[model samples]
Target: MNNFYKNYKGIIWLLTGILCGSVAGLALGKKIEVLKPIGDIFLNLLFTAVIPLVFFAISSAIAGLEPGKKLSRIMGVMCLVFLGTVIVAACLTMIAVWLFPVHEQLTGAILTEKVNPQPIGNQITALFTTGEFYELLSRKSMLAMIIFSVIIGFAALRSGEKGTAFTRFLHGGNEVFKQVFIIIMKLGPVGLGAYFAYQVGVFGPQLFGAYARSLGLYYATGAFYFVVIFSVYAFIAGGVKGMQKFWRNNIIPSATAVGTCSSIATIPANMDAAKKIGIPDVIANVTIPLGGTLHKDGSSISSIIKMAVVFALFGKSFNSADVVLLALAMTVLVSVVEGGIPNGGYVGELLFIAAYGFPPEALPPAMIIGTLVDPMATLLNSTGDTVAAMMIARFTEGKGWMENGEYGLESGVTE
Candidate 1:
């Protein structure tokens, strides 16, 4: 059993779990609902590491970098690529939703739940404002934590030797968190297996048939973006040959994301792909992790799709301001802390609710959207991370990176 578990791959286990869960769900129906707690435990375990993982991973990466104009340039390019693609994704989602509009009505158990509006100002303030330390632990204020980490990183960079010690401490802590995350992820197949079963039992197979049109449209759009948008990015970064190289190098990361349904889990593969595609270690190390935590084009797009489709289902139209707000929130706000898990998309769903006064009824459909779209979304997100790293390497490292010439990883080095 020890050898078996050791040899067992995570994706295989997850797929096996899904198949078993689906079978159990069909066999037992709602009778197996009692096992949901087990699935919840799995989800909770995955989320448990998220805050610390993000904080340490990003802060330490920033702190380790030598502060200078080159660092600034890379950061600028990375942010631009991440944000630009996310906005494009949101627009594409809106277009897809418009083309394949959903006309779903609230029925069955979905009609029973309603979401009340919360105080939006305080929640919004929590995003950019810093105060109590306790706020760092609150998942709702993840942006605040990210901002705080950035400050710490810069401060440490300026602190000289003292900062080095602190940064090292953070790096050590990050390793610890990574190990914990791996341990928790090992249980994912079992946990998510039960989750799949519960979802299938609760929703039934007809759920897919019911939402087929909208779901089909969402997937087709995903394919379009992956093939077209990524190709454009690759061409711009490394030209035609570069685009071919990127797709050829990216298969592992893409497969890992689709299988695990988590961009975070694809970090190792992303870094390797980046290396194969000639991105420097400095850029890959910093951007890949940071991208995993922040650059969420995939999730942003899915959120837009959900908002547009759900509104259309209820026979409503979003005004111009609402559209602007949706685009900004999904592109800028939710991207910062979008996790790489099954329900990670829920974070954006809340943003939709808060931003647009979407009712709780929005959640049921939103969840269905997540189930259908998350795998492709993760693939997009992970692939985008690699593309950003490549672009940044090209822009910051210039000829060496673009020409696929050999370059040593030197800190604060300039030609």
Candidate 2:
């Protein structure tokens, strides 16, 4: 039995769960109904893991990055790379949304009786206030926790011997949690299968019908982004040879991202790919970690897709101002603060819900789409990080970056 489990891949199990769960739900959900609790158990486990998983992972990644003088320069280049990708991703999403339009049909969509839209001022105020120390304990306040962790990470670096010990402790904690995450993921088949079964039972065949085309477009655009967009960036950074090296080395990282669906979780794989593609540890360690947190073309692209679909469902038409606002939100706000935890879609979904004053009911469909496409989105995001690392290395460290040849440091990279 153990050997059988060992030989089977996790993705296969997850797919099996989806297939079996959907079948069971359609066939036996009303009769049994008891299976709902089983699915809930898995979801609760996932939620339980989110906070500590995010806190330790982000801080540890930050602590493990190169210290002092090199930090700012690396972070700056990475942010630029992340922002550039996000803009391009946002543009692509807008184009896809325009090309494949969703009709105004909310049948079988998750609905709420009434939604009291919060004022923009109130929402902004609440975001910061809700992230206070006490409020940070709440699941909704992950943004605050992220900010706190980054501060603690930088402080750990400056604290001398004690700081080094603290960083090491966080890194150790991160490793332990990764194992825990794996263990939880092992149950994904049972959990996801049950969950999908319940969804199928409740919504029936219409569940797939509602979001199919929108999801199809999103996925098609994502494939194009990976092949065409990434290749273009690679060429700019390292030319033909560099592009070839990037594609060759990217296989593992991209595959891992699809399986894990978490950029933070994919860090180790991304770093490995970076090394294989000849990016130095100095560049990889800093840029990759920062990218896991900040550079999310995948999430940004998904945000636009979600918003477009949700808006269509709500029967809201986009004007020039609405389009501008969406571009700003997707390219900047949502892209930067997207959480690295699995099922972290709600953070961005909340932003989508509040920013456009969409009825809170619209959130479910948006989050549903985000959840469905998470693996593909994460693949693009994580893959882009490694590619960006290589690009930055070549541009900043010169064509000999692969050879570890020293290039001129920017003003703050050295003492």
Model 2 ranges off by over 4 Å: 1-8, 28-34, 63-66, 69-75, 102-106, 113-115, 162-180, 235-296, 303-379, 393-415
Write the residue-wise lDDT of candidate 2 on 279-365 in tens digits: 877778778987887788888778887877776655555435645564555457667655544344555666556445554345446
Among the numbered candidates, top TM-score falls to: 2
Query: For all candidates, what are the clash counts?
Result: 1, 0
The Cα error of candidate 1 at residue 156, in Å, is 2.7
Question: Model 1 segments beyond 4 Å from truth?
Answer: 1-9, 69-75, 101-113, 210-215, 230-415
| Whole-model alpha-carbon lDDT for candidate 1 | 0.69
Cα RMSD (angstroms) for every candidate in the order listed:
6.1, 5.4
Q: Each model's TM-score, in the order given?
A: 0.66, 0.70
Instruction: Give the per-residue lDDT of model 1 (tens digit) for 292-371.
Output: 97888777777776776566544456435645564566556666645532234655555455445454344445655665
